[model samples]
Each structure stands twice: as structure tokens, then as C-alpha cells.
Target: MKLSHIKLYPLAIPLIEPIKMSGETITHANTLLVYLKTNTGKEAWGETSAAPLMTGETLGGLLQNAKYLGEHLRGLDITELNSISMVLGKILYGNTSVKSCFEMAIIDLFAQAQDTSVWQILRDLSKNKTQTKPIPLPLLRMLGGSLDKEVADAALYRAQGYRHWKIKVGSLPLAEDLERVSILCDLLAGDIVSADANGAFNLDQAVIFCTAEKTRQLSFVEQAIAAKSTIDDFSLLKSKSHLPIALDESIHDVNEIKYFDQANALDGASLKLIKTGGLVSGLAAALELQRRNLKINLACKVAETSLSAAATASLGFAIDSIPWGFSMSNQYLEFDICAKPLHAENGHLNIEQLNPIGIGVTPEINLVTQAHSKEYSTVLC
Candidate 1:
């Protein structure tokens, strides 16, 4: 089906609690929501969040870039999944978040046109020949809020069979963060738990935190030092720390992953659709990580509605293993793009049952229209 229309909505859905991490506090999911219509009258939705520190994309930038791509891609066929992303990449330099949202829209529409699921597209793109057993992926919740609230949430989620956990460190002082991690690790004993510094640590502080006796119980530590920090710095930190180290911001492309691996600086990485340019690219990166025996954590940005969460969950099915866990972020939102938003229950996400067609979810445009964070043209592309 030919692409007939495109619309961009800049949204700022409030978060239940601020997602506090190293050097950042995101209280709302400032994002661009793309509403697409095909010549056949098929409609689909896609979204991307504003992560200035992580991805260097703001809401204003997301709105403008998405609008431009939508206009340029007006007459293209949504069936050309790979070409659409390539075109966006070539036309625009580095608004990966915007490109990701556009890719999500096209892929969602493409899968719907084929009467199949989005994962089928990514699975075909994957080069891995390993057989995959269909199992429900565990949800990794954030423990980044206040200490009392985090502890309370941990107990509640643990009772509900939640096992995977990630603590938001790098915001508070090093010793305090270490003590806090120690407390949570003790509370979450026997759980697959990790701490994300969000590139907040200096090499010395990171080594100190990782070497602390309490933090040693952690399953792994992620992006401890800054992205600007040298690979040798990461190697030093990795060697000094007692637990395994993973890189999120530091490893954007496959070459970086290989470089870090050769430098012996990381054990795993966090993969996001926005970071990798699109779902197809994200799957390719995941396959590379898997081939090299690196841990793969499929995640969304800080705060996003289920539209992006559904996209993330859909992509999770193509990967052979997700030992690091899936980070679907819709649960953090105070509002959703639609009444029937996708979500995980009992700490696990079952993708097929959630949406049997395409990406299996749709958004309520009426609600999304009112959730605008900034005024932008909803002009038909």
C-alpha cells in the first residue's frame, strides 16, 4: 500500500515518578507521536522520546525532523521497510530518535499490510540460525525513585514474581549510591539485578562503587563512566571492578562494540530502538552482540507510552535470548496514548496474546492530540 498521509504530535505525558539517573531527571515522556495512513486506509502509530543527554534529541528537534521525513516519505510504499529507514538515515544526519519513530510507523503499517507481526520482519532480517524457544520475557523494573518508594515497590513486585531489577545510580554521591545499591541488593537478593550509572561515574568513583562489598552482589553494572571517557579508562574501570560491566552509551555501532570487547572494557550492552536507528538496525545490532557472546538488554528510553513499548516488545521476539531482560516503559506513564495500551502482567510480557496482528496495538488519536507538549503542524504529508 502506498503511504497516503503522515502526522506528527509532540507529546509530554507525565511520569508517575521522575526517572532519576546520573545527571538526568525525566519527569515526563516528551516525545513525537507519528500517525500514519496508507492509501488502503490502514492507520498505524509510532513514537520516540526526547533524550537530550543520552541521544542528543529534544522534543522540538524530534517534531521538526519527523515532520520533514513524513513529508518526504508521503508517496513511498510502507512495504519497503528497509529502504524507508535507509532513506531517512541518508536524508537526515543524526536524529536517530526521529528516524526510529518513522521506522516504527512504516514497519507497523507494513506488518499490518502483510497480516503478520512486526517481529516476523526483524526475525527475517536476523542472520542467527540458532533455534529460539518461545518463552515470556521478564520485565526489568526501575528502582530509580526515592529509597523508600523503591524498597516498597521492590517488595510488591517481588511478591508478584518479579525477579529482574535495575537501580538508577550516578545521580547521588558515590558512597551514598553505593550504600543505596547495597541496601537494594540485599533486599533483592537472588534476583537478577544490575545498576545503571548512565555514564555518571568518574573512573575512580566507578571503581570504588563496584569494589564495594555490598555492590559486588550486583549481577552487573552498566555505563559507569562517561561516553567521552577513553576506552582505556573503561578497561581500567572494568579491571578494577569486581562485577561484570556493560556499556549502553559507549557502544552505539557494531564497531564500537567490537572495540570495547577487544579492549576488554564491557561484558554486555543495552539496546534501544532509538539508539540503533530502527527496529531492523536494532535487530542487527542485537544479532552481532549475541554472536560475540555479549549480554543483550532490550530497552526503551526513560519514559514512553505503550505505543513505543509495544514496538520494543514486538522486537524482543526476534532475539534468541534476552538474559539482560526487556525494559518496556509504559507502566511509568500517568497517561497512555490509547485506552488499550500494551503492558506486561506478572513481570512478564506475552507479545502474541497482546496483539495478534501487525504490531498488535493501536492508539487513540483523540487522546494523543490533547497530550501535545509543543504546538506543531499536524499537516497531512
Candidate 2:
């Protein structure tokens, strides 16, 4: 069936509690949700969340791009996802977040049309070895603002059955960062705690923090230095620190993977679908990383709704290769605008089952209506 209509909803959902990262405090999540309707009357959902600081795409820009994408998508065959992705990629240079949003919606719709989950679709597409058992999904915990807050946050997540936590670092003074790490270790005991620097640190600073005698409990350090830092610098940092490093911004595409390989820059990499464009590219990156025997951390954007979450869940199941971010399941802490809450049990999220002919869930009509009304009045989209 061909796509008949598409709609975009730009939303700002306030967080119940503020989430503080290195350079900013996030009190509300700003995101765009995309809806696609087929000629056969099937509907699918998708989400794209852009942090102006991260991707440099504002809400207005995202919405405009969504409109442009929607126009191109209209009249396209729903099942030809790869062709659609290629055509869109040729038109849009680096707005993978926008492209991914549309691609995901189409995939969701395709799966629903078949009355199956995205995982089943992916399993059928795989040429590699497939495991028979379901992989256990991991809980994602964020590192809080201060040393005391980090400890408290870890304890809070642990109480809720989370054993893995990711702490934010790099923005703090070296001494202060170590102090927080110490506190986190004490609170978490034997639990896993990874540190995300968010590309805030320099190579020397990252080396010092990773090698510091007081910081020994870290599972890995993520994007400790800016993406511009040379792979050689990462190699030097890796040599000096006991902790392994995971590349985030550093490995954006296949070419970058070769660069990292040549430089021996990291022990692992974090793959986000938006960064790589969609599930297809993200999976390709993961498989390549696996071929190199490097660890992988599958991550999601903060503003993702259930549509993107379902696709991410499929990735988690298909890989089962590593523990990664799946924090949307705990939206009570993060703030979610989706009508239905994502379900999590014992720190694990069961994959959302997509209806065989379209995206399983529909957009929250009231929220979308209100957003569109505001856009009409404000000329936002």
C-alpha cells in the first residue's frame, strides 16, 4: 500500500524531575512525533527527538524537515523501506534523525500489517547466526548531578531492580569527578556503572580520570573526549587508563569505524539509531563492531515515544550482544508524552508486539491536535 497522509506533532513534555547533564539541565523533553497513514487505512507511528546542543536541529527545523520528508514519502510503497531510505538520504545530507524518524514509522507500519513484532521481521532478514532464546533486556540508570545525588540516584534505581547505571562525568573538576565516582561505587556495591562524558573532556583529562587510583569500579567511559580529538589521542588515553573507552560521537559511520580500527582508539562503541540513520545502519554498525570483538552499547534518544522504543527493543533482542540504554521504559522519571506507558519488569522491558499490518499504537490524537493547533496559530511548522 502507498502512503496516503502524514502528520507531525512537535511536543514539549515536562520532566517530573530535572535531568542534569554536563552543560544543561533538562526539565522538559522536546520532540517530534510522525504519523503515517497508508492508502489501505493502516497507520504507523515514529518519533524524533533532537537536542539542539546535540544534533543542532531545533524543533522548528525538525518539523520543517518532517514536512519535506512527508511530502516525499506520500505515494511511496510502504514495503520498500530500503529504497525509501536511499532516496531520502540522497536528498538530505546529515539529518539522520529526521530520516530515521520516517524510516522507523514505515518499518513499524510494515510489521503491524503482518501482525508480527519488529523482531520477527529482523530475524527473517538476518543472514547471521540467530539464537533461539529471548535475550534479557537491561535497565538503564542515569548519573545524577552531584556526588551525593549520584549515590542517591544509584540507590533509587537499584531499589527499582536496576543493576546497571550510567553516570555523567567530564564537566566536573577532576577531583570532584573522582569523588563522585567513589560515592557511586560505595552505593552500587558490585553493580555495573558506566560513565558518559558527553564529549566534554580532553584526552589528557580523560586519561587522568580513567586512571585515577580512586576510580576503579567503572564498567567503561563513554565519549570522554570531543569527537574532534584524534583517534591517536584516544589510543593514548586507553593506554594510560585501566578503564575501557566506548566511542559515541567518534564513530558516526562505516568510514569512522575504519579510522577507529586503524588508530586502536576504543575498546567499545555506543550505537544510536538516529546517529546511524535507522535500524538497518545501526544493526550494520553493531555487527561490524562485533566482528572486531569490541563491546557495543545500544542507545536511544531521550524524546523517543513507544514507536521508536519498539524498534529499539527489537535491536536489543536481535543483538543481546551487550548492555545498553533503554531508559524510556522508566518515563515516570524522564517524562513521556505517549498515551500508553512502556512496560518494564525487573529492569527488563518486554518488546512491544506490533500488529501485523501497521504500527501497533496510534498517536495520542488529543496531544497531536493541540500541537497542530498551536503550530497553526504560531506558524511553527
**Model 2 spans with C-alpha error above 4 angstroms:** 128-133, 324-335, 352-361, 367-381
Where does the lowest 10-residue lDDT sum fall in candidate 1?
A: 126-135
The per-model lDDT (C-alpha) reads 0.82, 0.71
| Segments in model 1 whose C-alpha atoms lie over 4 Å from true places | 127-133, 374-379
| Model 2: ten consecutive residues of lowest lDDT | 372-381
Candidate 1, residue 330: lDDT: 83
The digit string of per-residue lDDT tens for model 1 on 1-381 reads: 677878878898889888877787888889788888888898888889988988899888888778788888888754577687667766788787888998888888888878877877666677445455346878998886788988999999888877899998887878888888889999999999999998888888889888989798899999988999987899999888898898898767677888989898988999888888878878777877888998989899988888888888777877747898988888888888877876667888876555766776788877787677755545455
How far residue 272's Cα lies from its native spot in candidate 2, in Å, is: 1.3
lDDT of 1: 0.82
* CA error at residue 305 for candidate 1, angstroms: 1.1
Question: Residues 1-381, candidate 2, lDDT per residue (tens digit)?
Answer: 788888777766656677766767776556678777889897777777766766777778888888887887688764564575787776677898888788778777777777866666665555545757546677576766656666676677688888877887866787888888877877787776788888888777888888887778888888888888776787888778799888887876667776787788888887777787877777778778878888877776654656666667676677765654554422533434446756556766654433333434556677555434244222112
Residue-level lDDT for 129 in candidate 2: 59
